[model samples]
Structure formats: C-alpha cells, structure tokens
Target: MKFQLDEPQGGNTIHRHDTRSVWVNGTEHRNSLLVPWQGTVEDWRLTRFEDLTEAHFERIRALKPELVIFGSGSRIRFARPQLYRALIEARIGMETMDIGAACRTYNVLASEGRAVLAALLIED
Candidate 1:
C-alpha cells in the first residue's frame, strides 16, 4: 500500500513534542484522532492488529492511556473480541474506527492531552 505522512498544520514535525493537524489519505485528522499506538511503528512493534495478542494488550495497558483506538484497516470489521475484553477489563476507553478515521481521531485526542494509542493496520 502507498503510505504518505501528511504534515500537521504549519507543516510542523509530527514528533512527540510537536502537535499539529494532518490528513492521512485525504482524511482530515487532528491530534485528537483515535489510534492504537504500538510504541513508534518506525522503531518497534510493527504488526497488524490481527496479529496482536494479549501480550500486546499488556504493553498498551502499561501506557495507561485514556483511550485505545483500533484501526481495522479501511473497514470496521474483524475486531478481536478477546482483546476488546481485555481492554474493557482494564477500564480503558476504546474506539474501533477505520484506519483513516483512526489517524484523524488519534491526532485530535493526542492534541487534547488525552492519552491515546492507535494501531493502523494499513493492509496494502
């Protein structure tokens, strides 16, 4: 799949410190976009949502994020009920949206200072 990183507003860096708006594949996204962050995809944990396991859930849990966004690729199906239950048991807010929307939501929430993570299952 073709992947492009749309810069946040002002074309600032989309780093840990810099906060800005962005568009992932024509979809508008703020820092508040929902996402299932797997500890910097560039450096570690590069895997699809379907490949995640309870151990992965434990890692995300350690982040203590307020919400966990699960990007089920471009479609909102194939949610791992087992993982969902684990998250629910931890009392973490969870949202399952399309990858595009997930990117947008992750940015929006992150900008708002809400703890959020995104798992973008970009299946090309």
Candidate 2:
C-alpha cells in the first residue's frame, strides 16, 4: 500500500492511501483515526485481538506507534499471552478496551502526540 500524509490545520487530519489504510495525524490505522471532539471515519479498520497475529504485528510494527489500542470486541479481555509477550518485547505499548472506548482513547492519545496505534471495531 501507498501511504499519503495530509496535515490539516485543525480537526483530525487524515492520511489516505487507496482505501485500505488511513492515519489521523501520526496515528496508524487500517481505516481511519477519529480526533477527539472531531469526527469519525466511514470505514475504519476495526478488529479484535483474536483476529491479530504475529504477521499483523509485524506489518503494524513498521509504523512504530508508542501505544497500540486493541479493541477486544465490545468488551475488555486480556490479550493472548503470546501477543502480550511479543508486544512488550518489541517495546510496544498496548491498551485493551471496548471498541468505542478504544476509538475515543486512540484519538486522544494520538492528538496529544503520542505514538498511538488503533484497532477499533465500530458499527455503521
């Protein structure tokens, strides 16, 4: 995928490439990253931890976000031991929360200049 960066003066700045990936400001996202009190994306990459693996990790690892917010479905559950260990070993910060909560949290952290990676599953 080709990634393009767009810097907006205000609100959430979205980066678009084709249609597979998007990033709000510097945050890494599969779909889109919503800025707090800003807005949301029509189609954002929303996923559960169970849907991720080392391969996914490797792909996202390239972004080098300080914290990766994992929306574990619509609930909060501890991430798999394997993933947790691997993420920690890679010095990647991980946050587990509900999908909606994750999205909100992601934007806040990203807007604050935190290296944030978000995986949120949202309903249209």
- Best-matching candidate per TM-score: 1
Candidate 1 lDDT by residue in tens digits, 6-109: 44332212233112333433444433332333233221143455565676666667667778776666568656768666677889987877766766677776
**Candidate 1 deviation (Cα RMSD):** 9.9
Off by over 4 Å in 1: 1-49
Location of the lowest summed lDDT over 10 successive residues in candidate 2 = 33-42
lDDT of 1 at 15: 36
Candidate 2 has what TM-score?
0.56
Q: Which stretches of candidate 2 lie over 4 Å from their true place?
A: 1-49, 121-124
For candidate 2, the clash count comes to: 2
TM-score of each: 0.59, 0.56
lDDT of 2 by residue, 15-117 (tens): 4222333455556555433233233433333344455566555554555666788665556776675755656777987777875667667656655666666
Candidate lDDT (C-alpha), each = 0.54, 0.54
